[model samples]
Target: MSDYFHNKRIVVTGGAGFLGAYILKGLQDRGCGHILVPRIEDYDLVRPADIERMYDDMQPDVVIHLAAVVGGIGANREHPGEFFYKNLMMGVQLIEQARLRGIEKFVAIGTICAYPKFTPVPFKEQDLWIGYPEETNAPYGLAKKMLLVQSQAYRQEYGFNSIFLLPVNLYGPGDNFSPASSHVIPALIKKCVDARDSGADHIECWGTGKASREFIYAADAAEGILLATERYNGPEPVNIGAGFEIAIKDLAEKIV
Candidate 1:
C-alpha cells in the first residue's frame, strides 16, 4: 500500500454514512490512519456557524466532502425544497470554509442524477450541462451539480487543490433499507424480501420501464474516491462508474 495518505489529516464530511463506511475502510486499507468524522448532529453543516466551527475544530489537511441530502425519487419529490436548500448550503459552505482555511485538498463527490435527462448513452463529463435533468430529480440534481461549478471556480481563482467526482448510482450492503428514502436497489430488495416471506406472486414498481441507469458497487465507488483524492488533482470532473448500463425493466427482472 502506498503511504500517500499515511500522515495526512483527512476529514470526510460524511465519514459515518452508508457510502462513508466503505470509504473509511478503503482509506484504512491504503494506510490512511488520520481520519476525522464530525457527525452532522454535532455540526450541522447547513448552518454557516457550524461549518466554521467544524473546520476550526478539525483543522484538517484534506477534506473529502460526501455529506449530502440524498435519496430515491420518492424522497426527492417529497422534499425538493429541503433537498435543494440543505444540499446547496452544505456544499457551498463546506467548500468555502475549506478554501478559507487553506486546506491542502478538497474532494467533492457529485452524482449522476445531475446530468441532463437525455445525455448520450455513455455520459461524459463534458456533456454535463447540455440540458436539464429529468423533471422528477432536477431539483436535487441541479443542487449537487453546483458543487462542480464551485470546485472549478475555486481551483481557477485560488488555485486550490480541489477535485470533483461524479459517481453513478451506488448500491450494496449497508444501504439505507428504509422505504421512504432508500434508492432503487435497496428499496426493491426490501420489497422483494417482504413479498417472498408473505408468499406474494408479483411486485409493483414505478416508471415506464424505459429509463436506464448505471451502477457502481458501494465498495468500488469508495476506492475510486480514495484514488481520486490521492492521484487526481485536476479541475476537470471525473466519473466513477462500472461502464455498463441497464434498463429499469431488466434491472428489476434481475433483482427479483
Candidate 2:
C-alpha cells in the first residue's frame, strides 16, 4: 500500500460486486481516503445522463471502471446483444465523461475473453487482435475490448491518463455460485458440493472437458489492478493471470 492512493478520491463502478469487493478491500488497505461506489439503483451507467450525474456527484480523482454485464456461456449465448450493448455503453460513456472531467487517472478492467479463440499457449498482450474470440462469448469480449482501443486513442489524442488490464478468469472466496451465471470454478465447486451432499455417484460438468483455462484468485487479481493503478500507466494493455492452464477435466478432478 503505497501513498499513491492516499488522499485521492476514487470511484470504483462495481465496488459491490465479486471482484469489486476485493478491490475495495485493497483500496481501503492501501489507505484511500474517499471512495465512492455508485449502486445500480443510484447510477445506471449505461445511460449517459447517469454517468454525467455520477461524475458530478462523486467527483473522483481516479475512476476504476469495473461495472459490467457478465455471465456464463449460457447467458452469453442467450443474451449477446444485452451483454454487448450494456458493457459497451457503460465503458464508452464512463471513459468519455472521465476524460471530460479531466480525472487524474482512469483504469479500465478488461477480460481474457478478448483474446482470440485459438491464442497460443502463453497468451501475449500483443496477440490480442490476431483473431476472433471464442464464439460463445465474442459479443461480451468484443465489447470489453473496445476499452483498450479507447484507452489508447484517448491517451494519444486527449493526453488523458488511462490504462486497460486483461485478467484471466478470476475465482476465489465470495465468488458467484449461482448455476445461472457462475463461471467455471464456482460452477464446478457447486456441482461437486451438491453431489457430495446427495451421495451421488458423480457430477456432470459442462463442455467437452478438453477446454483449458487459466485463472487468478480474485484477491491476487485485485492486488495486480491496484499495483497497475498506482504505478503502471502505459498505452499497451497488461495481462493479469496465473500463467498456467488446466484442462476442464483435470480441473474438475482436482476440485472433486
Candidate 3:
C-alpha cells in the first residue's frame, strides 16, 4: 500500500474492541504512527465536552469512528433504547466535533444489520434503505446507519471528508464468544468446543437455522477499512464483505 498513512496523527474509537484491535494493528502495519486510542475510562466520547477535549488534546489528522453499543439479538432485544441512544450520541458527537476541528478525514464504521430484513442475498450498498432493518437489530442498525446520513450531509454542506463503511458479520480471532454477546461464528465455536468436552450428542441452535449471513474476517475487514481510508472517497456508502454467504444451519453443521 501507499505511505499516505505514514506518521499521520489518527484516533481510532473503540480501538480496544474486537474489530478495533485488528484495525489498530492494521493501521500500524500500514505504518501509521501517532495513533491515539482513547480508553473509555479516560475519554467519554458520548459527552460533547469530552469530545471537544479530545480534539483539543490530540489534534488528530483523522478520526475513525468505530465506537458503538452493540450485541447479539438477545442483547439488542433487551436494550434497544440504550443501543439507539448511545450509538446515535457517540457517532453524532464525534463526527460533529471532527468537523469542527477541521479534521482531514473521518471513517465511520457501520453494520450489516443496517440492511433491511429481506435484503437480497449478498447484500449490496444500494439496498440499505429499501425497508426497515430486522426487528431484533433495528435500533442499533439505524443508529449506525445514521452515520452515513451524517457523512453525506457534512460533505454536501461543508465538504467534510468523511466515509461510511458497512461491513458484514465479522468473525475470527478476538471476537466475543460468550452466549450472551457473541455473534454466530464465535458462539458456534464455543458451543462446539464445549460440547466436545462435555461429550454431548448434539447442540441446540437458535432459530430454525434457515437464516443466512455473510461474514468478513476481522483481519480482512481491517484491511478494507485501511484501504478505504487511504484511497476511497465518495458519497455512496460502501459494503466491505467477502462475496460469499452461508446458511446458519449449514454453518453449525460445518462447525461440529
Model 1: ten consecutive residues of lowest lDDT = 26-35
Which numbered prediction scores highest in TM-score against the true structure?
Answer: 2
Clashes of each: 0, 0, 0
Q: Is candidate 1 or candidate 2 better by lDDT?
A: 2
Cα lDDT listed for each candidate: 0.90, 0.94, 0.91
> Which regions of candidate 1 deviate over 4 angstroms?
none
lDDT of 2 by residue, 90-176 (tens): 999999999998999999999999999999977999899999999999999999999999999999999999999998999999999
Q: After superposition, how far is residue 143 of candidate 1 from its true place, in Å?
A: 1.2
For candidate 3, give the lDDT.
0.91
lDDT of 1 at 38: 87
Clashing pairs in 2: none
Model 2 residue 68 CA deviation (Å) reads 0.8
Q: Write the per-residue lDDT of candidate 3 for residues 1-256, one digit (tens) a residue.
A: 7899897999999999998899999888888878898888988888888888888989899998888889887799899999999899999989998998799999999999999999999898888889999999999999999999999999999999999999889988788987987888988999999999999988989899989999988999999999999898998999999988999999999998
lDDT of 1 by residue, 132-200 (tens): 998878888888899999999999899888798999999998999999999888888888998999999
Candidate numbers sorted by TM-score from highest down: 2, 3, 1
